[model samples]
Target chain A: MAMPFEARYRVYWHHTDGAGIAHFSRILAIVEQAEEDFYASKGLLHVHGRLPRREVYASFLYPLRRGDEVLVRIWADEVRRRAVRYRFEILNLTAGRKAAEGHVVAVCVDSEGGELKAVECPQEFVEAWKEA
Target chain B: MAMPFEARYRVYWHHTDGAGIAHFSRILAIVEQAEEDFYASKGLLHVHGRLPRREVYASFLYPLRRGDEVLVRIWADEVRRRAVRYRFEILNLTAGRKAAEGHVVAVCVDSEGGELKAVECPQEFVEAWKEA
Candidate 1:
């Protein structure tokens, strides 16, 4: 099995809610940042803006407060002709435990001529994941 | 069966992503706004900030772009002693179709004295759902 791409981030006030913990929605954004970094590491920044999420599921295990450091790990769980499913885990380093984990299914689409059409995954993504 | 509470909103540039559609994460925030309004309608604003999400799932069916009007409907799916599962649907009025749908499972917790403890759902929520 290949090692998952990892990224670290610190929770900020804007990422949290009135409950003083990171808002559940922010988890998706954080994992997306890690996904972007993963693609950038492979010199495939262009892969962005094409893969829109089709489905997402997340479970929160531990709460993360503002200023808490988190480690996000992501890897391809499944690859299809026009979609990819990525599994991600977020660890709350301050609490020494898993904060949240989830999977996102993103479908590749082409938005040209004022219409959105499903497209096959880019060659760059296939090659990058293969190399990883 | 009871009718679900509904709220209408317009998608803005800030709510969209590079894909030219609403970012997947923003769906949760938008539904949360509707949830807050539902509570407020029942004079239960205090219910906010107490129920933190334990799990959430969303499936996007159709794309929603900037300036698109959306109608969000939410209702209690299941209610336990210390948790509630709320089902939600986001309809794209511009596209005249279901844009996204999902469920959120939130656990009631008491955050006092700098500690968080699981607690039973408030009586206000019970009454509100009963009325609904």
Candidate 2:
């Protein structure tokens, strides 16, 4: 199992969604931010090819409210020739609980001069994960 | 087959997510907004109680960018005693394509005086849905 990446974020009031709880849609926004952080830290940001999201799954265990802080924890669940699945857990730090659990899969792709095409996992990225 | 609920929305630049395309998560925000519009038109807003989201699934078919115009289409996919699944399609009206498709399942619940508990679907809601 790969070690998960963790980051913290606070809910804001801009979108005082239904009942004041965080909108379910924003959970993945947090997930995506943390995921990008993970890749950036390893210096693989754009040196590696782009990843287009394919699917997303999320299950809410408890509601998250405005001003509530949380930990966005993510890990690579599966890596294959063309896709990588990242699992996520939004841990509510304020209430000390898991707010939600989810996963998102991004398929690897190569783009050059505005042309796009699906590609296999870059060997360096695969090796890096293996060593992680 | 049931007629789907439909509404229009425009992309804003506030959180011009990754690569200038709309954040994958916000597709559901559009979905949720359209869904509430549908319920509100039926005059069922809170008269039947709340619907706490349980599960969400989304698949991206094409990228949606800021300034893009879209149609958020939604409808009930399943109706049970406790859960009603709403399917959504974010149609890129400006680009003439399907930007994304997804579903969110919200379970009926009864909440009174700051307490919450899951409850079966109210008969009135079911009947209204049937008549629609």
Candidate 3:
């Protein structure tokens, strides 16, 4: 199990929908951004490693309005030889309530070369995720 | 079960991310647009009834490149008294392949007055979905 990582974000007007709350589809950006920040914290990047997932599942608990501050926490829920699953918990930091949570599963892929193919999880990635 | 509704869309440049393919996050716009078009075909608008759902699950089968043409099909998978679940299938018509599919579950809410609260599915909505 890996420790969860957190980051803060402010909802902008563009994130809202006709409903006046954050659009559920747009939440993908928020979660993916947190995932990127999590890797950057460890001095890693998508260019250094590529793990593209095919599936995403999320549940929104509260409506996030524009100007709302959020605390998004992410962690590896499961790790396999060639795939990893991550969980995200988005909180209304101002209101101190959970707004959404979800999981994303990505498989290791060799995007460095011309053709992208599924690959085994690199040792450095596994080590960084588990040990650090 | 409601019959599936479909609409055609062309991939725009803004939908692409650094990956050069359609950004996963931006796919929301495509799906939501389809949803809106589906309703509009029946002379319905988001303002007609507010169904705000909190859950979304999606799977991308293929990467959608810019300038691609897509066919998005949506249908009601389940319809409850106060909630409805929709399924979306996005096909890359240009490539003759499936790009992605997902499910969105939204609950009915009353926004006419003040204080958004979950409400029962209106008769008109149920009738509109079934009859039309």
Candidate 4:
């Protein structure tokens, strides 16, 4: 089962440059916020924990302009032994175009804060996420 | 001639993770500050302006741990028509290792906020940076 989450973000002055377009870095911030919300919706409390050994990367396919109303869609794509893969889609509401698409991979780690390790998916949490 | 600028940044709580290491994004922020300082050192006032059509990108080569004092080096590597290339190197002071190496490319844009155009290098500004 996959969990899905949607979020709306407003373009702010801080998010734009003198040309009135969003800086590349600002787009990454919004995608990050959507990912945070995805985890919170899953009923998990590891928001601030050190993510084990997973890596996250993003690429911008199109430039987002300031004052553009955007919608971000997030969902889990797969879950492996100690890792989970998530995907994101950014849509430009005003122009009806796909602005960007990204994916993130996270690995579960031990509580000892040692090396990243694989763990079983918490069935209860997974179920709650599916319901959400 | 190459321009030089140096700035010291402390690893803050918001800059790290549960593993107590600096998050990759925070490193980009530090590098960005250095680039800003580089421009300011040259007496250029377009800090808040839309960088014409120039594109900038960054990559992380190594992980930086929390409480680590890292030094970043920024210098011009090449200049082409309508484009300026800059490079960054992150050094780990405690262990004496190069933490990361990255580069950014910024294009000069027109004042009307239209298409980016390559203008003759501002002779005065470039010379000012040589002395800084």
Residues B17-71, model 1: lDDT tens digits: 8777889899779999998999998888888789889999999998889999999
| Comparison by DockQ, 3 against 4, better one | 3
lDDT of 2 by residue, A26-132 (tens): 76677777877777777777733378788999998877777889899887787777877778999989878888998898888776543336788787666555543
When only the first chain is scored, the TM-scores of the models are 0.93, 0.85, 0.88, 0.72
Clash counts for all predictions:
0, 0, 1, 3
The digit string of per-residue lDDT tens for model 4 on A1-132 reads 444688988767788765666675667678777766766765565632534324444544445677778888877676565556667788878667676776666555554443334565566545544443
Q: How close is candidate 4 to the true structure, as a TM-score?
A: 0.63
lDDT of 1 by residue, A1-132 (tens): 577889999999999888888889887799899989999998888887888889999999888899999999988888888888889999999889899999999888898875678899888797666554
Those runs of model 4 whose alpha carbons end farther than 4 Å from true positions after fitting are A1-6, A17-19, A45-48, A52-67, A74-89, A95-107, A110-132, B1-7, B13-23, B44-48, B52-67, B75-79, B84-87, B95-105, B111-132
- For each candidate, the alpha-carbon lDDT, in order, equals 0.87, 0.76, 0.78, 0.61
lDDT of 3 by residue, A1-132 (tens): 457888999999999877788887677789888888877887777533466657899998877889989999988877777877888999988767898999998777775543356788777676666642
Across B1-132, the per-residue lDDT of candidate 2 in tens digits comes to: 568878898988853554566766666777777877787878777642377788999998777777889998887778888878878888988888887888888888776653346788888777555543
Best by lDDT: 1
Tell me the tens digit of each residue's lDDT in model 3 across B76-102: 777777777888999999889898999
Give the per-residue lDDT of model 4 (tens digit) for B1-132. Answer: 444567666567787755666766567677777777667766675632534324344444445676777887887666555456667777777557776666666665454453234465565545543443
Candidate 2 positional error at A33, Å: 2.2
DockQ of 1: 0.91
Q: Please give, for every candidate in the order listed, the TM-score of chain B alone compared with the true chain B.
A: 0.93, 0.86, 0.87, 0.71
DockQ-based class of model 1? high
Error of 3 at A13 (Å): 1.7
- Residue pairs that clash (backbone atoms under 3 angstroms), model 4: A50-B18, B52-B109, B54-B107
Task: Quickly count the clashes in candidate 2.
Answer: 0
TM-score of chain B of 4: 0.71
Error of 2 at B107 (Å): 2.2
